[model samples]
Target chain A: MFRYIVRRLLQGVLTFFGATFVVYCLMFAGGGDPIQALAGEKPVTAQQRAALTEQFHLDDNFFARYLYFLKDFFTGNLKSYTGRDVFENVGSALQLTGKIALIAIIFTIVVGVTLGIVAALRRGGIFDTSSLILTLVVIGIPSIVLAPLAQYLFGIQWKIFPVNYTFEKPFVSLILPGLVLGTLSLATAMRLTRASFFDNLRADYVRTATSKGLTRFRVVGVHVLRNSLIPIITFLGVELGNLMGGAIITEGVFNIPGIGGQLYKAIGLDDGPTVITFVSLLVVIYIVANLVVDLLYAVLDPRIRYE
Target chain B: MNEHLLEVDNLFIEFHTRDGVSKVINGVSYHLNAGETLAVLGESGSGKSVTAQAIMGILDMPPGKITRGRILYRGRDLLTMSKEERRKVRGEEIAMVFQDALSSLNPVFTVGNQISETLRKRKGMSKADAMKRAVELMDQVKIPGAKERVKDYPHQFSGGMRQRVMIAMSLAMDPKVLIADEPTTALDVTVQAQIMDLLAELRRDLNMAMILITHDLGVVADVADRIAVMYAGRIVEHADVHALYKNPAHPYTKGLLESIPRLDAKGTELATIKGLPPNLLRPPTGCAFHPRCKYAQDICVTTTPPLLDLGGGRTSACHFAKELLDGRI
Candidate 1:
């Protein structure tokens, strides 16, 4: 197990570097001049352009600029186009995003799995059919449409909660948007959980357990639930990665001051350094989340081995 | 006369399908005496396994319903028992070993845990006591290194060994009857013999009545005390093993016997039964097997044959049983 952990950590490092490299290539090499966009309609003289180019190190070759970014990234010297430290702002944003994702994931798993079990146990009944229909409806509606409507009903109409940004009570601010973002995911997880649970319930081992005179609860809890959890866990991990990347629109509407919000702002301003830093951070999160999922697979299923 | 351990009287089962409700077990009746091995032989979809599942109360609900039946164990009607009460009787008073050993046991759990859990539940044995008995049961079934190998999961065990584990699990509660449904079918020939031997030994040791459900005549010949040949959903013939093998009364039974390939006959195409068993959805009006029976006549196709006593503790369900007995097919 120790060896496996070490191997996984090493793989995690490699994946981080690969993600960083891809983001760096896409932001710098693939895109046209950021200075042109930054200058905008206001005409700039040759000296102004030259000074601005030198200031941002755009005068250097592509490889040189990439190496410079990588060095600064590791050294915590990444700066925004406005000359502010990128690490401090990006780090704070990441912390906020992390909290939201964590809370959403906890809510998704607990409620989703419970509802799934209830649906599976009472299959073909009113409760099962209703829950299945509700899940389909939620999954069909996009977060973009759901977020503003949620803000209008809960924030504007009821005035029960604040619609715009307020960091004083993070949990309160998070509840509406987080739930909106999490609804689709929760519905998806619940559907997957129900499917896997029913499949496992129909398995011969479940019948064997019943034939052993085990109570219905024990048969479901021990035999069916444990076997079904592997698929749900896998789906949760992938969905988490997706939620981290896909929270941009939801966060933008709520103004949660998270990495997703920061990425949206940087994209609007056409700030190359900020975009590169935030996109790289997103890539790192994706890679790390996938790595954690792979490790969890081995933990949940004994059949899987790192070696 | 031996006392009856289990008796099934006028048991009928119907399955609801897309087409319509089809009767699968049509007034099937049988009885097993204490310590006797009763073998029910039939082709696929002949309602043999359904009978076993119905007795266990594990049939899928909504679709499968026991329309009429009295499954009496020790003079108590199992059909009338509540779910909880039936559960108690299932693994403690009577247990079942399924046909596919490979699929029956959970692949994730250790063989010992599977057996011990049953022991713990049914016998009120502690974990430690159950574990000890698990090893003993594994040993009884002739599994090597019972102590060291008990921790291994089901997948690690071979097909025959897995079947042994299943048998061990069933016997853990010391049930009065063990219904083994094609226990040796998934195994190779040598492993089949070994499993049959182990079952025989366990039955003698526990003095438990067993119902060996199988399609192979040769398999039941050595283990079964009585044989019931089922055609469609009905038991067409039943007799003591010796008498049934010596002189099969029903035409279907005779055809089944003749189909078995014998080592004594060299370079000969085995006698094949003419047609498939009748579809249970819309079975023939009279005798279900008449379409496939060479001795079938106009009377056989027009009138149902009730099981009639043929003397000597035997019964046959055929329209022309008298003519067949008189050596006129």
Candidate 2:
């Protein structure tokens, strides 16, 4: 297990570098001059441009500049060409986004797994059919549409939660946006779980369990649901990474001061290092989530042994 | 009153399919007494398994339903019992070992846990005592080094070993009627023989009534006390094991006996029944086996044959049952 974790860490590091390289290339492929994007609507003064060029080594080859970026990135000395410290900015943003994402993940898992089990048990019945339709509707409505409606209904009309966010009361502010951010993944998780649980209901083990004279609770809960968890856990892991990456829209709608919001601001302001570092963090999140999932597979299923 | 341990009286089961209601087990009846093994023999789709599932009360409902049946256990009707009441009987009074042990045993659980769990639930034993008993049960089933292998999952065991684990689990509660549905079918020939031996030994030790569901004649020849030859959803013939083998009284049974390839018949072509089992959705108008029976006569195609007693506890569902028994076929 130690060796497996070490192997995964090495792979994650490699993937991080690859992701940073991709982000670097995409900044150039974005078709706007970095100097102009940094300068905003004002006409560029030659002196300012020269200073910026010399400071960032803009005349150097892509490989050389990438190596230079890697050095600064490793030493925790990343600063955007616009002069904002990348670590101080991205780190704080990540903390808030991470918290929201964590909440969303818990919400997704608890509600999704519960609903999934219910739907599977009451298969083809009213609850199953209605939950199916409900999930389809929930998944169909994008988070963009969902955020404002949640803000209005839960915030304005009902006064259940704050309309926007206040960092002082982080948990309270997370309620609405976290739910909006988690909606799609929640539905997806529920559907994946329902499908997996349904398949497991037909598995030979379930029949064997029932034949053992086990109560319905024991058979469905212990035998069927336990076996069905592998797929659901896998989905949760992937969904966590996706939630962290995809929180920008929800953050923007609700004015949550998270990594997503920071990324949004940095992109609008065209801060290259800030945007690159955040996206690279998202990639790292994905890799780490997958690593955790692989480890969890061994924990959930006795048959899976990582040598 | 006859003290039959497990008796199925005119059991009828049907599956509601896309086409229509397909009768799977049609008026099937049989009885098992304590310390006796009854083998329900049939080919695929011949309702052998459906009968087993019905007895266990594990048939998938909606699609499959017991339209008419009374499964009497110790003179009490199991079919009319409430779900909760039936559940208590299951794994305690009437346990079942299914085919494909690999799939039957939960992959996520250790074999020890699976067996011990039943002990804990049905016997109300404590965890430690249940676990210790699980090891003993494993040892009883002839699994070597049961102490060490108890922690292993189902996949860690071989097919034969897994089936043995299933047997150990089923026997954990000391069920009076143990139904092993094609328990040895998934195993290799040698392993099949070994499992049969183990089952027979265990049956004798516990004095439990056993129902061995199988298509293998060789398997039943050694283990079964009585044989019920099922073809298309109904038992075509029933007799004591020795008598059934010596003189099969139905054409279908005769055909089945002849189809077995004997070692002495080196060059002779094997005798096979002519047609497939009748489709239950639109079963043949007459005797279900008549289409495949070589000895089938004109009346056989027009009227379904009832199971008629031929004395000495023998029964055959054929118009020419007497003729066949008299060696006139």
Candidate 3:
């Protein structure tokens, strides 16, 4: 197991460098003046431009500059275009996005799994039909459309929740947007769960378990649920990175101060340092999520030993 | 001792499909006494496995419905029992070993966990106690290195070994009746014999009544005390094993016997019943097997023969049963 984990981490490190290199290449491909402050409203003097150029080694070739950026990035000396520490800016934004994603994911798993099981148990019945329709409608509604409507109905009209996020009650502010953010994924997970549960419920082993005098609850819970989770877990694992990407839209709609929000600003301004660090973080998230899922497979199924 | 440990009286099983309700088991009846092995012989779709499923109360409902039947266990009608009561009787009093051992056992669980689950749930044994008993049951089933192999999952075991694990699981509660539905059908020829030998030894050792559902006459000849031959969802003939083989009273049974390859008749075309088994969707008007029976007569085409009791514990559902017995057909 240790060897397996080490191998996965090694692969992840290689992917991290490759992903960052691609992003760097894309940034350089634009062929814009690298030393210019794209965000600054003030006109720059020649002396200021020359000073910035010398400070950043903008005159060097692409590979030389990339190597210099890599050295600075590794040594934690990389800075944003606005002269702020890139690590400090991205780190704080990351923490907020992490919180929202964590809550949304938890909500997704609970509601999706419960509804999925219920739908499977009542297959071809009223509950199953309704669940399918409800999930379809939720999946159909884009968060862009859902966010403003939710703000109107629940925030402005009903006055139940704050119109925008507030720092005083961080968790309270997250509830509505987190649920909104989780809706699409919840519906997707529900469908996957229902499919996998239906398949496992029909398996011969389930019949064997029931024949052994197990109660209906035990039969479904222990036998069917464990068997059905393989597909569900795999889906969730792959969705982790997408969840963060999705948070960009959700945080924007709710005006939440998170990494997704920072990412939006960075893209609008085309800040190379901020975009590079933020995107690299997403790549890391994707690689780590896959590793976790692979490791979980061994834990969930004894037949899949690491060896 | 109870004369009949388990009995199915005039059972009628039906399958509701997209087309219509198809009667699968038409008034089939059989019984098993304590320590007796009754082999239910039939081709596919003859409802042999369905009969066993009905007995175990594990029939997939919706598609399968027991339109009419009474499953009696120790003189109590199990059909009338509550779901909870039936559950109590299922693994504790009567257990079943299904066909395709690999698919029947849960893939993710260890063989020991699967066996011990019933011991823990039905028998209310402690975890440690259940584990110990599971190891012992594995050993009893003649699985070599039981203690070490208990930790292995079902996929790790070979086909024959997996069947042995299933047998051990069913025997966990020391059930009075064990319904083995085509248990050896998924194994190789040599493995089939070994499994049958293991089943026979287990039956004798446990003093358990068994319903051996099989399509092979050769398989039943060695282990079964009595044979019930079914055709078109009904028992066409039933008698002591020796008597049925020596003098098959029903023409269908006679046809089945002749179809078996004999070493004495080498190089000859193997005898085969001319037509296919009757489609249960719309069975023939009179005897369902008439189209496939050479001895089928005029009356056989107009009326379904009742299962008549011929003294000496023999029953045959063919009108020409007596003629066949008298060598007149």
Pick the DockQ winner: 2
Pick by lDDT: 1 or 2, better one? 2
Tens-digit lDDT track of model 1 for B1-329: 45478999889999999898888999899998889999999989888999999888888877999999899999899999898899999888889999788689887678899999977766678999899999999999989999999998887889999999999998888899999989998989999999998898889888999999999998988888999888788999999999888878888888889999999997999999998878778889888888888877898888999998999778899988767767677
**Candidate 3 lDDT:** 0.88
User: What does chain B score (TM) in every candidate?
Assistant: 0.97, 0.98, 0.98
Q: Which stretches of model 2 miss by more than 4 angstroms? A: A29-39, A43-47
lDDT of candidate 3 over B31-146, digit per residue (tens): 99999999999999888998888888888998999999798999999999999999989888999999999999998889999999988887688999999999999999999999
TM-score against truth, every candidate: 0.95, 0.97, 0.97
In model 3, the runs with Cα more than 4 Å from the true position are: A32-41, B1-3
The true-versus-predicted C-alpha distance at residue B56 of model 1, in Å, is 0.6
* Model 1 TM-score, 2 decimals: 0.95
Residue B33 shift from truth in candidate 3, angstroms:
0.9
What are the runs in model 1 whose C-alpha is more than 4 Å off? Answer: A1-15, A29-52, B1-3, B122-124
lDDT of 2 by residue, B132-219 (tens): 9999999999999999999999999999999999999999888998999999889999999999999999999999999999998988
lDDT of 3 by residue, A1-307 (tens): 9998998899899999999999989987866654554636778788978877787777889899889888988899998766789899877777777777777788889999889989998999999999999999999999889888888888899988777888887877777787777777999999999999999999999989989999998999899999999889888887766776547777898888787888888766757777888888899888888888888888887778784
User: Per-residue lDDT for A101 in model 3?
Assistant: 75
lDDT of each: 0.86, 0.89, 0.88
Predicted candidate 1 versus true structure: per-residue lDDT over A264-288, tens digit per residue: 8777666767888887777777777
Candidate 2 or 1, higher DockQ: 2
Higher-ranked by lDDT: 2 or 3: 2
